[model samples]
Target: MIEILRKRRSVRQFLDKEIEKEKIDILKEAVLRSPSSRGINPWEFIFVTDKELLEKLSKAKKHGSAFLKNAKLGVLVIADTRKSDVCIEDCSIAAITLQYVAESLGLGSCWAQIRLREHNDNISAEEYVRNLFVLPDYYLIECIIGIGYPKNKPQGHDYSTLQFEKIHTNGFKND
Candidate 1:
């Protein structure tokens, strides 16, 4: 797991190749296994492989989402707001689990945050997604994980660059 973490990097550029169905299934299982608060498992996923839809979804936000147009798959991470109080946290764990499984399978993934973003002046990103998918009002969009074969795999962040100072002892102490 540590090795996978060491090599994992957010990949925005992907090759024009479709992800294998077996790998997609594995990703499905991985997210289902993701830990949730009291096992309420409020998260849900929409595996999008349609080219036209992916293209449209790429415009979900003004920035940081254009690259999703080229992704072979877009996994919408949403949650039932009424199911759990920690819906965001549960969705986040599932999203990261999907990403890690993608990395382990020689696939690349990038996350596009949707919870608090704008698609345009008329609507929020979440609202645009809701309208696009015709989702119910009780569902909350957390993010979209764009997955595909990487066009170019960038190296992970160097260990020397890690912020070791962020780690604290038993209690929070000012420097």
Candidate 2:
């Protein structure tokens, strides 16, 4: 598990090769199995593999999302606040776990943030994605994870130094 965690990194470029169905299946299983608060599991995933649509999705944000155009698969992570008040937090954890699982499968993934952003002039990122994907208004877009065989491998963040400065024994003690 530690090895997988260390190996996982944001991969923005990909090859033209296609991902196998077995790999996709494993990703689905990992996503669905994610634990949620109160077991509400307020998350839902919309997968996009069409090249044309993926390209359009890459423009779902004004910036920081151009890589979706190269993603062999796009996992639009969303949550329905109607299902749980803590839907955002739940979806975030699921997204992280999903990426970790992807790394374990020898795939690379990059998460594009979209929760509080805009696509262009006046379209909110959530609205932009929702409109493009035709998703219901009840859903809130959390992020989009671009997955594929990396065109190049990115070295993971070196953890050897371990930022102990940020760690606290228990609670913050006022200096």
Candidate 3:
């Protein structure tokens, strides 16, 4: 797992190739296994592969989401707010789990944050997505993860660059 984490990087540029069905199935299973508060599992996933729909979803945010148009798959991480107050945290865990599983399968992925983001000046990114898919108002859009074969596998962050200062022992120290 640590080796996978060391190699994992957010890949925005992907090769024009479709992901294998087997790999897709693995990704689906990985997210479902993600842990949630008291196992309520409020998350819902939409695995998108349609080219036309991917193009539309690429515009979910003004920035940081244009890469979806070229991705072979986009997983929308959403959750039922009515089911849990920790929907955000739960969805986040699932999203990252999906990413890690994709990495282990030799695929690259990038996350496009939807919550608290804007598609346009007047419309929130979440609203645009809800309207596009006609999702219920109770469902909250967390983010969309774009996945595919990487055009270029970028190197992961160097260990020397890690912020060791951020690690605190038993308690917070001002030092």
Candidate 4:
């Protein structure tokens, strides 16, 4: 699990290959198994492979979403805010779990932020994706994870770069 965590990176370049259903199934299972607050699992995923729609989604954010255009599939993570006040946090945990599962399966993924972003010339990024995907009014857009085989593999993170100074004991210590 630590290896998977160390190896995971924000993959932007992806090969134009279809992701295997078996691998996708694993990611779905991970999401379903994610721990949620008060057992209110607020996440609902939309697995998109449509080319035209992918193009539209590429415009969901003014920036950082262009990579979705090249991804073979994109997972739009939506949270039912009406169900829980902490639905965003719960769904975010599920998203990270899905990314870890993808890494374990040799797939690459990039997270495109949508919650507070806005399209270049259109409405809010969340509204754009919701309208395009026809999501319900109560479903709040969290993020989109663009997934596919990597066109170029990025090197794993070096442990030396970790910020250990951020960690503190029971009593806070400066310096």
Every candidate's lDDT: 0.96, 0.90, 0.97, 0.88
What RMSD does each model have against the real structure? 0.7, 1.3, 0.7, 1.3
Give the alpha carbon lDDT tens digit for every residue of 1-175 in model 1.
Answer: 9999999999999998989999999999999999999999998999999999999899999998898999999999999999999999999999999999999999999999999999999899999999999999899999999999999999998999999889998988778
Per-residue lDDT of candidate 2, residues 45-129 (tens digit): 9888999999988998878999999999999899988999999889998899889988988889999998988887877888989
- Native RMSD of candidate 3 (Å): 0.7
| Evaluation by TM-score, superior candidate among 2 and 3 | 3
lDDT at 22, model 1: 99
**Candidate 4 residue lDDT tens string, 22-124:** 8888888988999999998888889888988888888888689999999988888898888899988998998898888898999999999999898756589
The Cα error of candidate 2 at residue 4, in Å, is: 1.0
Candidate achieving higher lDDT, 1 or 4:
1
**TM-scores, all models, native as reference:** 0.98, 0.95, 0.98, 0.95
Clashes of 2: 0
Which residues of candidate 2, in runs, are more than 4 Å off? 173-175
Best-to-worst ranking by lDDT: 3, 1, 2, 4
Better of 3 and 4 by TM-score: 3
